[model samples]
Target: MDFKTEFKPLTVQPQEIEGKSFEIITEELGEHPFTEQQYPVVQRIIHASADFELGRSLVFHKDAIEAGIKSIREGRTVVADVQMIQAGVSKERLERFGGGIKVYISDPDVMEEAKRLNTTRAIISMRKAIKEADGGIYAIGNAPTALLELIRLVKEGQARPGLIIGMPVGFVSAAESKDELRKLDIPFITNIGRKGGSTIVVSAINAISIMATALK
Candidate 1:
């Protein structure tokens, strides 16, 4: 027996794709705990990953979205934990407001410092990045060490980022790092368990950037 194949390509306007994606995501995700303001972040994450589990895993502070949007609107720089996260972000969107994406993991100074301190390059990179962009957005998606260092810096009153997007994906300390981030008395976006990565982190920032553009 032979059956005819039926395949239909999605024919939607460029602007309508995002709206349609959100509609489908919401429909599949059912009821989400995020408020209207926070929904965009969640929708973007699911939109990037096609994983509805993020709807339940993602946790946002009461003022997380508000602070993130404020930072984006102010043209604050984005400091990423790794190059992949930086590459994944929408540079055109960020540049619209005079902001830029920075990743210091590959810097020679960071490598030397990491070697001397016997720590991961991500930690040293975070230290350097925070100095360059004091009140920027911190997007940590690949390295738990970077997230931990950021928390330590914040506690020491050395680093003061406007918002933290902690979504590092790993088996070793990923969950623990997010737990520590949640305890900070600052604006942050994170998810429970071990389901996160550079893609979701970039998605979160892109969502905030898009929202900022709309607000302008």
Candidate 2:
């Protein structure tokens, strides 16, 4: 099918989020993207990847999950908590669950700050965050250094495995993080390309939360 990509800008509404649906926040982009024509195909791909969350700004939600599970079935979900990735060394280890592996990237703005900080402080903070996560949700954030640190961690470990989700909210850094994860041959998904905000990250998480709730 010839699917056209839309470029509608969106705003995120945090308080309005519920169950698995988010308020329509793509008004800024107009009828460019997220229209009926594009939602299905985009929904299909996300479903293939087992991503079924919705956002107040953009992305798919609960309805998308039901549609998605019908097609793709054989993957794991990883939740990269906002803090875990920011922390540095011992972030959560959902991959430790031992399955197809899915990753959820958190807020990207936070990482941008870390990236610009002093090298020593940045490393120290990251390391602390990792230790705190110990295998929890932690997005690589928008900081290239943070993503690079994650790459280093993976390379040095040689035992970690699963999908990587880098939701950086910047131009170069977000793209770079996604590239790094791709290089590792780790299946990944991200809103970095759109300069996504925290809402996008939350939307991705909401997708996984659907399955999580279902399994319960």
Candidate 3:
């Protein structure tokens, strides 16, 4: 989606100013796919066409969810059981969230395994659901040039997204992508160091899910 309208000018504001509306650049929302309201203020503007009653919905894959739970019940800590989110890493809760371990995807074989094992699929599916409601997920996968090209496209009046989730894990280009994402000032949840993998992505998703529930 190309944004042709420029409201005032793109100047960063320290706080929301009353009566001052900022232009929200986002992709076209045909059929709302988001279930949970990620950003209330922005949703009102960008998702104006969407029905609030049916904002976004989440239907966790039962098998996947169960597997994650069973892993923890069996006392396995070698790998992260990121199915049920226990608590926030930054928060002291009823239970410690993860095993304090990090995973990274740097090999093609591992990436292929992640896809086959349904980890990658789960993350992609969740993201696609969000994209359906607003725009597409903006971030560098394993390609920094592609991300810059995408930004160029949006800047050059080709395409744009309402939100961008920069969740790239590990690669020779991960640092470059992270830098570009920071420069773009996109909203995202990321792990420290090279922590992009099937487990890591799911863990991040679980973390957000827990946060959403906690807010309620």
Tell me the TM-score of each prediction against the true structure.
Answer: 0.92, 0.45, 0.32
lDDT of 2 at 58: 34
Among these predicted structures, which one has the highest TM-score? 1
lDDT of 2 by residue, 79-145 (tens): 3434433233221222233322222233253345446664633333345544433233334444555
Model 2 spans > 4 angstroms off: 1-117, 120-123, 158-163, 191-194
Q: Which stretches of candidate 1 lie over 4 Å from their true place?
A: 1-17
Question: Number of clashing residue pairs in every model?
Answer: 0, 31, 4
Order the numbered candidates by TM-score, best leading.
1, 2, 3
| Candidate 1 structure quality by residue, lDDT tens digits, 1-216 | 996658655754766987788889988888767899988889989998998886579999888888988888888999998888888899998888899989999999999999998999999998998778879899999899999999999999999989999999989999999999999989999999788999999999999998888985
Stretch of 10 with least lDDT, candidate 2: 86-95
Candidate 3 least-lDDT 10 residues: 78-87
Per-residue error for 136 in candidate 2, Å, reads: 3.6
Error of 3 at 34 (Å): 27
Candidate number that wins on TM-score, 1 or 2? 1
The CA root-mean-square deviation of candidate 1, after full C-alpha superposition on the true structure, stands at: 4.4
